[model samples]
Target: MAVKSDFLVIGSGIAGLSFALKAAEAGRVTLVTKMGPEETNTKYAQGGIASVFSDEDDFELHVRDTLEAGAGLCHEDAVRLVVTSGPERVRELIAWGVEFTRSDNAASNGYDLHLEGGHSRKRILHAADITGAAVERAVLAKVAAHPRIKVFDHHMAIDLITRRKLERRRKGKDRCLGAYVYDTKSGDVEVFVAGATLIATGGSGKVYLITSNPDVASGDGVAMAARAGARIANMEFMQFHPTCLFHPPRGKFSDQ
Candidate 1:
């Protein structure tokens, strides 16, 4: 039997959950995660989101810092878009109940922004040390309460069902219909038919022997996309350890 919905979302990380929460406003959403939604890479992010929320920070400076950090690999358009919209988008997270840390009455809003290594100013808004966990919890709570959203845990998407798979390889841009999902618990494959499908599985950090990313971050979604002929590139680039330089009132060598 085929399960149908307005949107089929794979993976239950921040990306997947965020998209589903918004998409559910207009139509029904069916979200599937390979494992329980709580075991996501998003919770591992200790550092927090970067946005221009302080008096000293601005979009251009943030964009420049990001471009410099990327070492010329980041797309300029993408950088600009993210930098400009970052504050607003992060505010949306706040609206969704992400309790970003707050301190120092220096700023008007009183957010405890951190001076991350690459940034020229203090802009990283966090939730103490478990920033990602806080974000994930907030979004997950909202997603759970949403009436139009249905969640399926322990379901892995094996492959995307594209138009090419349905019909012959004719021309014109082929569209995606849904995916073939495998239920780990039931040990059966189900066809998910949706008007739109989104893949939000996190990075492939588990490819390495020793990694900080959880075992579930095995890049399965990337493989699924590649198998579906979705142009995959920049495979060489990988983040060994996303740096977050912690600097308290004093130094790192000794506790002041």
Candidate 2:
């Protein structure tokens, strides 16, 4: 059977959840998560979102820090936009009920940010050690409360359906129409149709024999996107942990 929707968002991470919240306001949204909505790399982020919230800190410094960390491959315009708009976006997160850590009355003045590795200033807005958890929880709660947003957990996407699926060459470059999903619970396949689809599935830390990513982090989105004519960049770039304890006693570390 095929399920239809005005907008479909794959993955329940920060990006997909945020997009779903925005899209649900205008039309129907179906959020498909491979695992539970709360299960994602975003939930394990020990660090936090970088934003220039204090008067002492600004976009220029943030940009410099990001560029330095990005080495030489960071796009200048993208860096500029991200650093410049980061603070407002952080504020938007606050409006979404993400309560970042505050201290020294800084939250009242602006925000009490922290300095992480590769950063020159304390521009990271965090919620203790589990900043990502706080953000994800807030967004997921809102997503659950939204009447127009439908959630499907444990639905793994097998591949995307494009104009090619229709065998229609006249559709030009072949746009994405929907996807083929495997329901983990039902042990069956389902075709989901959507007018618009956004892929927000996070990292591919599982490709490595030793990693710090969830079991579901199998690069599903990257694979599906590449199969759908979308270019997959940064495949060679990955995080490898040499000291990862793979024993059952410490399997949690390898599970990410």
Candidate 3:
């Protein structure tokens, strides 16, 4: 039997939950995660989101920093969209109960911002050192209480279900219908049918032997999307952080 929803969201990271929260306003949403809802790359993120929030900062400066970081491969349109909409998105997060660190400066908005390697201004909006965790906590709380959103933890998506899988006779294009999920606890494969499906399963950090990402970052979403004939881009670019918290035996310090 297939359970149906208006929108199906895979993963529980900042992207997934944030999308689900907004989508729920229009229709019913089914959110699926491989582990507990809180276990995600977003929960492990220490740094903050960058935006032009200071009197000294501007969109051009932020875009220039991002372009430099991308090493000339960045898309100007995408960069412009993010830089322009970042402050409004941050305000939305605050409205959802995310408390960012405050500043004592009288000229500022009272929220403490930090400067990173590529940026020239202190435009990083953070909740102390665990900005992602703070954002995740607040967003997940809203998702849990929303009547239009249903969360399914410990459910792993094996593959995406497309129109080809349904054996439709008159197919104009290959459209995604839903997915086949595996319940880790019950050991059962279930069908989740939806009008639309979203894949926001973070990165493929676990593909490397050692990484700062959580165990759930197994590149499942990327694999599923590729298998479903989606064109993937920028796979050659891999960003590795210089410092990762070392855990004995499992995670050791990397010199690279």
Per-candidate Cα lDDT values, in order, are 0.89, 0.85, 0.90
Model 2: per-residue Cα lDDT over 70-177, one tens digit each: 779889999998888886788789999999987775543555678777887777888988998999999899999999999999998888899876885644667788
What stretches of model 3 exceed 4 Å from their correct place? 168-172, 243-256
Please give the lDDT score for candidate 1: 0.89
Give me the runs in candidate 2 sitting further than 4 Å from their true place.
106-110, 168-171, 240-254
Q: Which pairs of residues collide in candidate 1?
A: none
lDDT of 1 by residue, 13-78 (tens): 899999999999889999999999888999888899989998877888999999999997999999
lDDT of 2: 0.85
User: What local lDDT score does residue 245 receive in model 3, on the 0 to 100 scale?
Assistant: 62
Clashes of each: 0, 0, 0
> TM-scores across all candidates?
0.91, 0.92, 0.93
- As for candidate 2, its clashing pairs are none
Question: Tens digit of lDDT per residue, candidate 3, span 143-235?
Answer: 999999999999999999988656744445788999999999999999999999999999888788668887888899999999887889999
Model 1 quality (TM-score): 0.91
